[model samples]
Target: MADAELYAALGQLKLSYRECIVLQKIEGYSIKETAEILTCTEVQVRNHTERGMKALQKLLGGEIDEIG
Candidate 1:
């Protein structure tokens, strides 16, 4: 998808601030780095990543699962 389309879809997800930050790929940091940046535990980062991705996948009609 185009950047604009992806951004629009993401906006529709209404995610938490942390989820949005992580999903937006801020500098493409790993989970550890993201946890440090967000001042949260690595578990929280993983949770956000998983939940954000699931929401995105659902919103985008589950096409992400077909990528493989």
Candidate 2:
């Protein structure tokens, strides 16, 4: 996706989910590192990432499988 469009999709996410995606996916942080930086449990990081990806995919009109 284009940069502005991608950022717009991310803007649609809840704040915590957006932070998780930015830290873990965009910044290339490990899951453990994301949890540490976000000051949340690893489970929370995982959950946010999952939901964020799903939401982003929906906003971007893309099909995303859980396996991805």
Candidate 3:
């Protein structure tokens, strides 16, 4: 898809700016690292990721099996 389309998909995910920042910027981290850096639990991080991905898929009009 085009970059605009990708961004539009991301936008439809309903993530706050901060949540988007953490996911995009800290993507290099392991689950533990992500939780530690975000000051949240691994479960929370996973939940956000899942929800965000689902939203993105809805925006993209497809089923997204992965985010990366």
Candidate 4:
């Protein structure tokens, strides 16, 4: 889908999840990098990215399959 649609889907998530997706996917940050930027653990970022991508995928008609 388009960036707008993906962004809209991202908006449906919780703030932390949205931030994780934006930092890791949109901003091209690795899990370690995202964790550092977000001041969270790498495992936390990983979990957020996984769940966020799943939610985004469901919202965008299953178009996202990267983070999982």
Top TM-score hit: 2
- Sliding window of 10 residues with minimal summed lDDT for model 4: 59-68
Give candidate 2 regions above 4 Å deviation: 63-68
A best-first ranking of the candidates according to their TM-score comes to 2, 4, 1, 3
lDDT of 1 by residue, 1-68 (tens): 55665566667764564353443364567778777767888887777777777777777777564211
Full ranking by lDDT: 2, 4, 1, 3
The RMSD (Cα, Å) of candidate 2 is 3.0
Q: After TM-score superposition, what is the CA distance of residue 30 in candidate 3 from its true location, in Å?
A: 1.7
Report the error of model 4 at residue 57, Å. 0.7
Instruction: Report the C-alpha lDDT of model 4 over 1-68, residue by residue, as the tens digit.
Output: 66677767777899999999888777899999899898999999989988877777788887765542
lDDT of 2 by residue, 1-68 (tens): 56787888788899999999888778889899999998999999999999988888888888444321
Model 2 lDDT on a 0 to 1 scale: 0.84
Report the Cα lDDT for residue 56, model 2.
Answer: 88
Q: Please report how far candidate 1 places residue 65 from its true position, in Å.
A: 6.4
Clash count of each predicted structure? 0, 0, 0, 0
TM-score of 1: 0.71
Question: Per-residue lDDT of 1-68 in model 3, one digit per residue for the tens?
Answer: 67576766665555543374346443556767767767888887777766676667667778545444
For model 1, what is the C-alpha lDDT against the true structure? 0.63
